[model samples]
Target chain A: MPRCRVRVSTWRRSVVGGAGGVEACRSGEVPYGGGRFNGQEGSEDSDSSVNRKSYPTTLRRHPSRMDQSESELKRFMSGLTLAECVGFVIIILTIVWLQYYRGGFAWSSDYKVMFNWHPLLMILSMIFLYANVMLVYRTFRHERKKKLKLVHAGLFLVIFVMAVIGLSAVFNVHNTAGTPNMYSLHSWLGICTMVLFACQWLCGLLSFLFPGVRHALRAWYLPVHTFFGMVVFILASCTVLMGLLEKAIFTLNDKTDTPYQFLPREAVVVNVMGILVALFAGLVIFLVGNPVFKRLSLPEDEMLLNEPIN
Target chain B: MPRCRVRVSTWRRSVVGGAGGVEACRSGEVPYGGGRFNGQEGSEDSDSSVNRKSYPTTLRRHPSRMDQSESELKRFMSGLTLAECVGFVIIILTIVWLQYYRGGFAWSSDYKVMFNWHPLLMILSMIFLYANVMLVYRTFRHERKKKLKLVHAGLFLVIFVMAVIGLSAVFNVHNTAGTPNMYSLHSWLGICTMVLFACQWLCGLLSFLFPGVRHALRAWYLPVHTFFGMVVFILASCTVLMGLLEKAIFTLNDKTDTPYQFLPREAVVVNVMGILVALFAGLVIFLVGNPVFKRLSLPEDEMLLNEPIN
Candidate 1:
């Protein structure tokens, strides 16, 4: 076994490879083209190599822990998108199950329908649109970088509107029911996540889109922006889980004649949704975090770097 | 701005730096000494520079985002440890509040004591020991590499034992009550996390500590090991949260006379605990993810590279 001389004084590009760096160094796995370690299989040349060349040097070197190729990663991404779609469907069905089956969703019926819209819209905004915004870079890797930014910004705007509607629905419920708002943990986290999301979106707009902010400031804020986006999304998911549990508790307590002891259909639905929601969030985070899965930076990125308005 | 001629062909040392890498590149922050960020006001040369010299060349080049001195990081760590301690105390008190006040623990009584032990021991093992196991490397960064390994392995062993006791206690409660086990989502997640923890611990022991395992295998397994450790710990915490919610729901539902429409004190306590637990997990993840906060790799790491038994 020949000692792999790792030159140490290089800059920080190495660490972003993260655990892969440690693994690569220790194993001395032939750089990129060798190991079958991280589930990398299938044809290497199915897709255009544009995305591959666009990758950061570290990613080009390490690829991923999975050593995923362009075609393989695309397949994985498609599977993930499918899983996400299914999760979305499950979330919607669960809301409908809780509302329609439980006699909560009638347009003619006043406040319950409004309350029903809270969960539906919140899931739509928080889980669905929020995930799409995060995935824009990945999904449209071939598109112009500027177009992707607009798409991201546009999606976020839609999310904000949906979130606003969701918030009003909940507030309307509290108002009509004469209950104090923000009393529950669910409400507290929900409101906090929403407020933080709004702040994050506004700052992102000012720093990235509205222009006039220094390039240095935007560069500094990018990681923070990425970090908080994931955090707020996680917080929202947890808040939703708590909300489901809270609702289940209240409903169970209200029911007088039910003889069900342990596992009911409603509880089963809730549990499955909880699992799906968690898995969905985890997968999205994984894709966002992995550089191999990132959209390729276009030539326009260089142009934007030079332009003052970008 | 002079073009920072980032040497392209250098190995992936930079990405491994992560947050520190980002900060260094963006701020071009003077290696480690010149900048006064992150409360590094006093230090010029208080500690030995052995650890500094031992850092990978990339870290030497990039150092940290905040330019936090060793003493400052140590101070930050101490503060975090204190916060962790406070959080641990809060968790214990909350359990006590729930058990003693809400009626579970009675030494004089027979079966209830067994039931009470479930929550107490689970929190002790699942949250406290699990978190400590995750933090051993970070907390004792300056310790001899061998000693840190022993500490990590030792802490995990204790966690495993505690978890076994915790599981049996829950099982005992179910057996005593003639209730079915593994029924609730809480139970399912709890059991799954425990099982995964056992597998992870065993694989870790074999791959890392056991003598016959090849270095290449250990290197490949390291990232997976680190990742699963965090994942299982998080799952355990989530399981505990779900367990608490499950218990609260059952207790609330059982009570016939209490006309509690608003958030009760018990609910508030549970919610606060949930928030604290989530925040603690988030903080630990942040600390672990930030390379600047990591304990510097020692010369012993190099020595181990040559040793066949390591």
Candidate 2:
């Protein structure tokens, strides 16, 4: 009975800590010190306020704020790790399914090989890099705001380069295959998202990072900036999803059977990749929007603001 | 010059009143009188403190609360009308595209006819009704909380009935065609969403509406309920999007041409419908998430609580 109680308490900790849900049932968290030190066990309620008031100074001899910060840290780490794993799975499944299962990728092998680079590079740039850009502020809350802005700008620049390369791959495939470019809804949406993404990056840099902009103007633009940042990210995600389904039909059109015949291994993998990518985007949006998991803005971070970059 | 100035000021009023954003640009209000009273304007900044200090009594020549409430009313009205239009458009376009362009709907004339009802009913239930469920709290914020809960419960029951009909149509079509059911990723995700939706409705009814639940327990469950409610709505939207793509390919696959050939009229309409549905979902999610546009909570809303229903 005692063993079961200990095991249950550990499971609850990791679950409440936001890392290992039922999926990661092992609930692995290396105990740093006294195993029985956390006196705030047995209560499974998720009321942060209740926990704060009841368990303060009881869980440890440390300050209540320290205990709260630790929990917040655990939540942040767990959320990011889960989101990262999902993002990586999307990339890996897309590449493996396209490369090994269909045909391997090559520089200029054929339309098929060229088409393969489209999903891989686009996912890498749009989903992975764009997600990191959204997360930079939250992840490095302790860092100087000006430094984080530079990092954010730098990451967006990388995304621009990757996006150009990815777009070229798709256009190259279209030209080689004698297929018309921007003919379908997918291509239209994809190109629009890319163009808007470029414009958004340039606009963000000019408005936020560029020197000589008055503080009042920057403050006025802040809400619009945050709104568009999220909007553009969502647009990119929508375009990617549209591209996934468009590609699925193009590659999996079994004339002998119905279209999107998921009985086939490749089709199933394609659909799974699409769902996983959508879920990853959803998780990213959730993490960014939720205040409880957001990083605490520090005094030094605020002081570092208004420092212009070249 | 005075006429032009009046027109400009009217436009500004609508804009500052939160009804002129792209998502709510129709600015449709019932106009319950007292037209030129709101004096909160010309500041051109979103600083809440400035607004509170400047136009506290000037607007409507009444209490500041009245001014804030009027703006909230405008927002609520505009948001609802816009969502209603989008929801109706989704239903109408699905019907027209499937009925007029793709040979029209029938009960058992063919599998295609049976499949037509699937999209229509599913959109009505999943997209339309589910979205309204999210908006109800915001839309009817001044209503008694018990009454709103009843309305919510009642609306969900309607969705349950519609969902049953939608599922039956798809299953019947599959059975008649002698095709396996629940095989594709679309089907898997759709079914999972439906099951979860049902469970959510039941759990919400039990915990929030039931008489036996303690106040502390109910408060503890509120956040979880709110979180899952949004999550399930998102999942449903995602499933609908997948279904749109799946159905588009199945119907638009021209053997002689590339898959999803947009030259076909039906194909173009289908793609347009998909994009519109996505935009609609995006708009709905945005309105629900934005606090500035949220409705003002009422005092009576809190008193009538924990009433059981059939």
Candidate 3:
């Protein structure tokens, strides 16, 4: 493989000097595009006079540690795979608890049964799909930024639809049954997570996906966007845990056969499912936050950095 | 203010090249010590020959942006202050919930009353105090490293003692009341948190507080220490939320007059307390994780980086 040269210009240095500079650089702000590895090096016009001046002074390729980086990349891939599996397990566990124990899902036919769909769909959309969306950039580190952005937006749209359906399931159950809505802590946090999530998604679309957003604004909003994505995901996880606890206690108390305090098999499964959701959330956050797993800046990214398209 | 000179040598570059390089540097590995600002410039012996060769190439001071950084620092301080106040509110709410609603705490007189101490003490030690301990490094960014280390360890010691007493309160209540322990999800998670907290504190004491560890090991362990620190704190928060849900349901179910589903005044207070705890934990984690609030490296840290005492 040919070596990829990295040129650190004066303008780039200045951009990296302030509070969010390093994070911006890491989040594809610094042009380290993947085009160089595809033999497209030096093809782009060096139109920026600033880049031309600092070209010779800071032109250097990192020492070839292909073997080491390869191993590390493999480790990262394995970790991602493990996170996906754990997420799948959580989804399955939820289904088992709902289908086998709580008498499977239905809509309008049985209000009690309809409530089961709430947990299942929530674990699928809010926890499972949300986590996978967070991992998409890391998973496709070499993909074009424009393509990845579209994929991200598309996936979020799907997640939003599923979340709406999940919310309706619980609300319908409560409304039809004449039970007070948003009375529990779980309901309160769940609504908060959903509201914040919708706002986050709308803001992301307007600021990032739309062409009218200014480069400066996008650069400034990137860190805030990243921070809230993690926050909303975590809040959703906590809400689900509380919901599980509420369901378990209500179910066990209403039925004398399986008390929650006795550690019934169903209770154990519910607890394990909650634990798995927390673990999955933690792993995704760690993987996303760790710099080692960050996408390597490509030569083409340098142009984007100067022009500010992404 | 004196301008501090930063010299980035080849050896330092290599150390920063690996997976954890940036984090290590941010955590005080690259030796951008604070002595220069104190008029101690060039006082240390530059015995390493590598430094001599790279001095001309990398020796440069960041463009003095004292005004920019100063305001940013103020913003960070304000954010921290808000987090602290939120944490204090969580503590106050927990006390009010326990003292006003649940009969006040006692050692062994009434098992039900004794259980009240468990939540109060755990909130004090595990949630409130733990968040403060995480903030100490950022709070005293310019303090001597040795001094900060002692303070960190001392704070952890206090936290540990309170956590132990908190654990005993619930155990005594459970044993005396003949109720099974560790049966619910909350108990399972609470025990997991306490055990992990103990292991983390002990490992921290041996590796950091003691003098025998190698520089390489300490350097490697620092990132792990920081990651697990955040993880354990989050797990603790999740556990506390579950425990609150359990208590609210059990208390409401046991007392027919105040059903949890009816959303009584006490139930609302309990739910509000849970939400406050989650918000406080989120704020603490955000303040601790944001790079903008990181402690500035000092000139004395350079020597420690080279010598490896920390």
Top DockQ model = 3
Task: Name the 10 consecutive residues with the lowest summed lDDT in model 3 chain B.
Answer: B34-43
- What i-RMS does each candidate reach, in Å? 10.7, 17.4, 10.1
Instruction: Supply the TM-score for candidate 3.
Output: 0.81
lDDT of 2 by residue, B1-310 (tens): 0000112233334334422221121111111110111110111111222223323233323334344445655665676677778878888888898789667777884877778888888888888877877677555543445766778788888988988898899999888888777766667667767887888889888877887676556644554565566666767776776677777666666445545644567667776777677677767766655544433233233343634422
For candidate 2, give the lDDT: 0.58
- How far off is residue A198 in model 3, in Å? 1.0
Task: Kindly give the stretch of ten consecutive residues in candidate 1 chain A with the minimal lDDT sum.
Answer: A34-43
Residue B269 CA displacement from its true place in model 1, Å: 2.7
- Which scores better on lDDT, 1 or 2? 2
lDDT of 1 by residue, B1-310 (tens): 0111222112113223322322232222212221111111111111113324323456445445334344435544664666476567656776766575566664333555666667767777777666766766556544455565666777788878877877777777777777767656566567777888889988877776675566556654665576567667767777767776666666554667442335577767766776677677666655544334444444344344225434
Candidate achieving higher lDDT, 1 or 3: 3
- Which 10-residue window of candidate 1 chain B scores lowest in summed lDDT? B35-44
lDDT of model 3 at position B115: 86
- For model 2 chain B, give the 10-residue run with minimal summed lDDT: B32-41
